[model samples]
Target: MSLLTTLNDDIKTAMKAKDKETLSVLRMLKTAIQNEQIKAGRDLNGEEELTVLSREMKQRRDSLAEFEKAGRDDLADKAKIEITIVEKYMPEQLSEEEIRQIVQAAIDQTGASSAKEFGKVMGAVMPKVKGKAVGNQVNAIVKELLQEN
Candidate 1:
């Protein structure tokens, strides 16, 4: 099912179950999706939907980090919950091993032999791993592999 349709259904389920936290997150996600559609002047495709979801996930993760750094466990816990909720809609994440393999392949394909060619490897790898791996993780792996070359 489309992400919007699934979100709608889950919203209803959350309401029926009186799940306040889940209901709130679902409504927020639905609004985000609608806003993106309006901004684009068309409904989002699957990839676009994934992009929105990933953005939401990233925001929560960043917030979680900030909250933890400031010793605000309460807010950090909330951000963790939000992250978990958003993760339900994301594509299955790639493992580190898988990301390493993909990054290696991209480096080889792009003939990026050194850190100076970081952008070339990233450009090639990002498209293939879009929505499946975190950019930072992939970047670190690329750098580690490149430095070893």
Candidate 2:
């Protein structure tokens, strides 16, 4: 089934199971996807849907960090729950080693030999790694590799 279809089905399941937390998070994800579709004036394809899922996951992660920093354990726990739910819909994340390998390849492809060419390497790499790896993590790896070259 398509991701959207699966999500809708899961919403029904959550409601049936009286899983309030899961139901809430699923509804939020549904709203986000619908908003993206309206903004684009068309239904999202797989990649676009994945983009929406990744955005939702990122928001939860940011909220989790902020909540933890503020010592709001209750809110942090909620954010953690939301994050775990959101992560279920995203693509399996790439490991740091895998990301490092791809960044190295991007550097070679772009012939980027110095930090001065960081943007060029990032532009070449981001599309290939989108949703699979976090941006800052990939950026750090790229910077470390470039500095060594």
Candidate 3:
């Protein structure tokens, strides 16, 4: 099913169950997806939908980090819950080892042997891993691998 359709169904379920936390997150996600559609002047395809979902998850993760760093346990706890809720809609994440392997392959494919070719390696890798991995983690692996080359 389309992400929007799935979100709508989940929203209804959350409402029926009086799941405020889940409902809130679902509403926010629905709104984000809708906004992107409006901006594009059309319905988003699966890849576009995944892009929006990834952005939302990244924002929540960044918020979680900041909250914890600031020692705001209550807010951090909420952010953590929000992250978990958002995660339910994401693709299964790639493990570090899987990501490393992908990055290594990209480097070989692109003939990228130094940090100077970061963009080249990343261009080759991102499309392969897309929603399955976080950019920062992929980036770090690429850098580590390239440095070793």
Candidate 4:
């Protein structure tokens, strides 16, 4: 089934199971996907839906970090729950070591020998790794590797 279809089905399942937290997160994801479709004046394709899922997941991670920093353990736990639910819809995440290797390959492929070409290298690499790795993580690894070279 398509991701959207699966999400809608899961929403019904969550409701039937009385899974309020999962249902809420699923509904939020549904809204985000619908909003994107409205904006584009067309329904989202699989790739576009994955983009929305990734964005939602990223927002939850950021929220979790802020909550932790403020010592709001309750809110942080809530954010973590939402993150876990949202992540169910995301492509499997690449590990740090795996991402670092891919980033290095991208750099080599782009012939980016210095930090000055960071932007160019990133542009080349982001598309290649898009659904597999989070942007900020990939960016940090790229920066560290580029700086070292």
* Candidate 4 residue lDDT tens string, 1-149: 77879989999999999999999999999999999999999988888988888888889989999999999999999999998888778888889999988889988888998989999989988877777898989999999999988
lDDT per residue (tens digit) for residues 1-149 in model 2: 67879899999999999999999999999999999999999989999998998888888888888999999999999999998898888889999999999999999999999999999999999988889988889989999999999
- Candidate no. 1 TM-score: 0.98
> Per-residue alpha-carbon lDDT of model 3 for 34-137, expressed as tens digits?
99999999999999999999999999999989999999999999999999999899999999999999999888888998899999999999999888998999
Which pairs of residues have clashing backbones in candidate 1? none
Backbone clash pairs in model 3 (N, Cα, C under 3 Å; residues 3+ apart or in different chains), count: 0
Mark the 10 consecutive residues where model 1 has the least summed lDDT. Answer: 127-136
lDDT of 2: 0.92
Regions more than 4 Å wrong, model 4:
none
Scored against the true structure, residue 115 in model 4 reaches a CA lDDT of 89
Model 1, residue 48: what's the lDDT?
Answer: 97
Report per-prediction Cα RMSD to one decimal. Answer: 0.7, 0.9, 0.8, 1.2
Question: How well does each candidate superpose onto the true structure, as a TM-score?
Answer: 0.98, 0.96, 0.97, 0.94
Pairs that collide, model 4 = none
Residues 86-120, candidate 1: write the lDDT tens digits: 99999999999999998899988989889999999
Candidate 2 stretches with Cα past 4 Å from truth are none
Which pairs clash in model 2? none
- Worst ten in a row by lDDT for model 4: 125-134
Model 2, position 63: C-alpha lDDT score: 88
